[model samples]
Target chain A: MGHHHPGSVSPLRTLTAAVRHHRDRNVGPVKTVKLPRRKLDFFASVLQRFGELHAPVARNGHFVFQRVRRWSEARLEYTRTELPPKKYFLPPRETLFRFTPGKGYVPESEDLDRRIVLLGVHACDIYSLNILDLVFNGKYPDPYYQTRRRNIALIGVDCIPDQRCFCRSMRADTVEQGFDLFFYDIGDYYLTLVGTALGDDMVLAAGELFESVTPDDVAEYKRRSQERHQRFQLDVEIRDLPEIFEMEYGSEIWEELGAKCLSCGSCSMVCPTCYCYDVADETQLGSTAGRRVRTWDSCLFATHAAVAGGENFRHSRASRVKFRFYHKQRGFVAEYGRPSCVGCGRCSAVCPVGIDIIEVINRLRGVEYAETEHAATR
Target chain B: MQATKPTVGIFGLTGCAGDQLVILNCEDELLSLVDVVDIRDFLMAASGGDEFSTLDIAFVEGAVMTRRDEEKLQRIRRRAKALVAIGTCALQGGVPAMADGLDWPSAVRDVYGPEGDGFDALPARALHECVEVDFSLPGCPIEKHEFLGAVADLLNGNPPQLPTYAVCTECKMRECDCLLVDQGRFCHGPLTRAGCRARCPSYAVPCVGCRGPVPDPNLGSAMDVYTSKGWSPEEVVQRLRTFGPLPTPVPAGEAA
Candidate 1:
């Protein structure tokens, strides 16, 4: 269960194949190239011609995706950023439109056309963006999200999985598409995979900086990929887990977790796929005009399921907690043919009370667990 | 403008009056607020309105710590169609209420000495204990934007929507590293209500729960998180009680 390979019989398999097929069909064949370690800075400098550059930078003793004036400021080797790259697409707060008594509503177009080159993203993050694309680009598409998607260029980089990372188990440890360029470290050189026409343009613009990948480079890339695969310390079984969630609908574990759950909404906020939001209108003082706005919302919040006339659909903490898990693991499977979680483990790292996803899933699968072993301290 | 403007009053009781001060601190929006709403009675900023006239909305701050405070609150509730309780003092019986079970006479004597004999102060209680509160905006001193937003909602004939999630929501949204999880620090962000925008955590300072507890605070697990970090149960409870009473979680057997 812990050592499943990519394209295994799991919920993520179909979606992963779909994404790869879509990219291969649209962008011709993926062009594999190599750039020397020393020329990385030179390559990044050339990327500035396309758009403003952003990369992971140290902030308050943690990493965050920030705009960098120079390539030296970007921490390409950072483990994880506090917030996912989703902040670029679905912002924390955004004004949809402004309304006036006589003029009606005017849509806001601020920052929609700004181009950005987001650098050093991990595979899980890029995959999460693909999931978000499915949601935001569906039947009722969001113009704001679609515009941002078009403006921002994703440049993904390979990462070493930390103790919290479970991307390998979720099949998100490696990405084949949804990024302009994906770089894998192979000692002295980076084996880059170009997935889009824009990526080809970036390489062509760089001239001699990028070199063609030889047979030895391909062998070295395979060796490093295998090494990275073995480094994942955490794992969760995804096969038949959605059915298990359905069977455990009446389990006492939900009540116990609810009693222990803080309902802080931290997990959802840090998550890459939890994209629920709440919309509201703000009226200006001494005027009939106002602006409609939306902010990130979580199903764990008491008010998330609340309605008018003092009625709450999920009034109990146990029910709300159950709803969050069921929605991600079961409900999403029915709708999108896959679970929504990318298994990035940001939720595990950010939960103040240590409500880990891996632990919960393992418990639901009837694995025995002791209190001291699963304590919140670790 | 006077024909359509709502008559509003601001009142204070026993706390630091910091919540009212936050309103006064809204310098840029203060004139705009006065332009829209008729400032009938605000002793801190203006005092020319008819104090006896009926008020459409009344903003009350501070806790009820004296007999006079109770009477004033009852009067304000009677004359106002909508009464909003602002700040942790009025909503959750802040700092002053921390001495509820302690010896009051000796405690007062320790501070005021001989002058304390004539000081008749009742135990600190929240405004809801003395009168019906229409709405509550909780913070040590209510956040300026929250106060302004609530007022704007009331003026627009809509119920004010306050965030029900914990401070960790905003803290994560601001991309602040979790003080409790990342570092071995004591932060009340998990149990404390949001709307302070994770201000303390953004500066790398741990939250002290000045906004009081969230509606569904998991005290058991919060204690577990603290204890696992080497804090004793007594230490955790004492820290939680610093801002207000730690709400007791309903027993699992009794919970819905």
Candidate 2:
């Protein structure tokens, strides 16, 4: 229902429109190309020239984004990675600067500009990256994140909807921008969308590898898109979700969820968009020299709100859980005209306990039967 | 340099001296450590010490399991400027205190026969139960880096900062897949204190909560989570008791 605007455009719709405008204004008209499915393996070698090629690979019966020497090592059809491509930009831990008492502070700039080509990114992930760009590219831009973003190239690929996926409900199933190149598998070929001049250059470099799309190919694309859309078993109505979240601020459901929450922060770490970090000055054992390090932080942690005076703003676990939801679904919408969550289902899948976003939202809306039924079968 | 350095002492009570061993295991840092601090008392590492002298900092490991242990802890607390309880035994009653609620006299009799009656033993309890503990560095065996960090902080005249968050924070940072969610493993990482850097989980092993409980843990809900995976409540409690005494379960709907 949220996907279909009946009378007037919503704030998120306006944001999406603005995103489209921004993309078109910067890249001119969208150029479509085709690459034979068999040629993809050979194209991986060509991609290496641009940067260190990283793609999803199997690890311990799960998928992880790792550097691959050969295309055979990459698992393009992976449902999700243990950690998102955001790690390549924000990193789990990074040194911001090194300081000495008398010598002053020296900025850490090592490997800030390492070129990386992230292949097989999902649409929701690319959309999440765009959201990250909004946060990091503000007035006081983070030089670290910005530099990494500039150096890394994204090549998104279409994904098959899993039981956990709810990206369609979040309006992130298809991305209009934020990726240099996007590939959609269609039988024997990949319908590629060149999103930028850099992407166009890649196509140019590939030369004979790419071909023009045909009318039959366009019809096939429409058919596959419909099939993909219908395959999404999980859906959450985002219409007036921010308002619902505001009304349910004192809902007892938070207590129940918080009681069940382990607060391990696995969901936040695996998330494509969660970007909160904590900074600390880690001094050497015997020297005055220390490096100011930044590490990933989660609102769910007990110490997230702890201050110098030993007063915790969100001391209660229930309040911390509520804070995470309110920020992603309510506060973020107020500021960015869109929700921060892309519904990538990483939080749901990675949670040790069954604290699913879809189930939680459905429960809040008082339509819990569908998700409950699906969960029972799962 | 030794005269200019701060005086420190390391003492053990009754539990296994694993925590002190972790300090000695700091092979690389130990040489530099002696140069920076005046380690006046360390029975395991040195021959003699002036027990009457005041210390700038005192690191006490193990729990108060005997009347003598309690008396010794009180003496250490009185002479030290600041006392830090090291390891789970000194913070929470670790594996040693798991027998606290059991029939200790009969249990000891079974282990040592009639000779056990001669052995005088009080209920095993953490050092804080008998004496004031200024700080605590909790782990089954205190982590080597954590001990080194505490010493480093003491050398700079700063209070040692320890992780207040749970083991899950470090586990996630390491990007280890959720063993509990994915494989139905009963990991206590969510409730356990951090600072071991998630050593077990990184190797595809579940945490046994050797670091003790984090602040405001949801105990009842954690039980429910484990029970749902076919583990009985008693079994869950049994697994938890391997490291430390079980805390009272915080019920659902209660703010934790």
Candidate 3:
């Protein structure tokens, strides 16, 4: 029912043990283990024994990560999920505290010790999770988020870039770490790379299903990675994006975008790294006792910037639109040394009005032009 | 000392009494609600003599279409301390308000006869237009949870917090695939107010703007999306008009 705690040993001893384990097998820290296509179900079933299993599944012609009981339910070949894996860590709504009228509040902390294995996560979403880690785990760490992150294990899968995906431009098309295990499709088998000790534990649990990878298999894995790199349909030059955003602060493009913005907050809702939230108290009918809950909020909403004095910081649609972009592209980088956007394309895919991030970035760079025909007709 | 329960009334005017029925649909919570509020007037669920003297809170549903409907609404507004417009009809005039664009007299005559079949008719108007409405709970049929929550908030001397965001927000939370983006369907989710938990999208149907538009919807952009997807400007307006006409009128014969 439980596994040995890695923390029980000293950091030096743990590293030495890992090194000894790898040397004993004559493998590098990044070893490629061959998983035969037929053994996927057996492997998933074995993984399920470790924790609550979740994977992407086909729903209403789109993919969404949902709890899966069977291996067959996991749609491993899907391009993108309607919602990112962020929901597992930071749910849409969660109770923060409960309070009675006279009595003070009692914090409703979650039990984060329960094991959860998220399978079939794409590279961009994994990168997004890493960005979230920097936000929630940095400075004054959020205990709730930190605990949930500690309990969950991420399993990454190589994704075939769709027309909407621009992860390559963000340098998030492939991840080196932050995942327990990463799977790459190499013809008849999956070349699985163990990224962490937890991944090594998983491999040991289902050792029979995996075989030591040969040199030929490693070559095939590298060739497949190269092939996927060229398949991306969208690209954005992100090196000087922060500078461009700074210069384009007063660009007319924002006003044009604001005119088309629905202000629905769908873009933020679907974005993996957008973690803005609002808290409210919900009391029971005819009772003084209630729970304070936190729900996902968006800066795009009109009331998001409103204060008690009726002063709204970002009053106009243009300001809100610009603020959202600048926050993701420039502001985050100034604070975190990296842009918050992982180029997952969920925002573009979910936007009702077809506001693509790549187009916005390219237009900002003066490399592309907006469709003037539509604007002129309007 | 036991606290006196607040007197409440539930009334309907000129549309399908679906919203009141939704209140009845809250079978589990209905009993608890009854224990909390003193329901003085509720015609749909329970039959009682009209005691419209003074109500702590009144939930009025349906649109005010006729002279009698307007008078009844005014009477309710006078009696009730706080009037909450429940359902799309009372909030935005609902589907019945579509007749506002047409010649009412001719439409009424065509429906009935030259010698009118008795009841006087007028253009469908929202309750707020006729009387002072304290709050509004908007939806095709008001969501049961929202209705109950509003009632609870009023009982607790708290203003009921309503969602200002569009249906697209809830649709995204439900993780439903964007019909407009994926299939190029004319979904009104972006423009329409939420609080229905995106029921239509969850069931694979596009939002029909039945909950009415959000506070500051960019209709121009919404129409642009539709027109770009090959939908005619007339088609877009027709769809928008299905629930009720927007506050800013879509120009006549203009391709969006």
On lDDT, the leading prediction is 1
lDDT value for candidate 3? 0.81
Candidate 1 at A2: error in angstroms? 40
* Winner of 1 and 2 under lDDT: 1
Interface RMSD list for the candidates: 1.6, 1.7, 2.2
Best by DockQ: 1
Q: Rank the candidates by TM-score, best first.
A: 1, 2, 3
Report the lDDT tens digits of candidate 2 across residue range B208-250: 9899888767778887778789888778878878766876454
Model 2's DockQ score: 0.54
Better of 1 and 3 by DockQ: 1
Tell me the whole-model lDDT of each prediction, alpha carbons only.
0.84, 0.82, 0.81
Cα lDDT of candidate 1 equals 0.84
User: Candidate 3: misplaced stretches above 4 Å?
Assistant: A1-32, A106-114, A369-378, B1-3, B50-52, B248-256
Candidate 3 chain B has its poorest 10 consecutive residues by lDDT at B247-256
Query: What's the lDDT of the predicted structure labeled candidate 2?
Result: 0.82
TM-scores, all candidates, are 0.92, 0.91, 0.90
For each model in turn, which proportion of the native inter-chain contacts is also found? 0.83, 0.53, 0.74
**Per-residue error (Å), model 2, residue A322:** 1.3
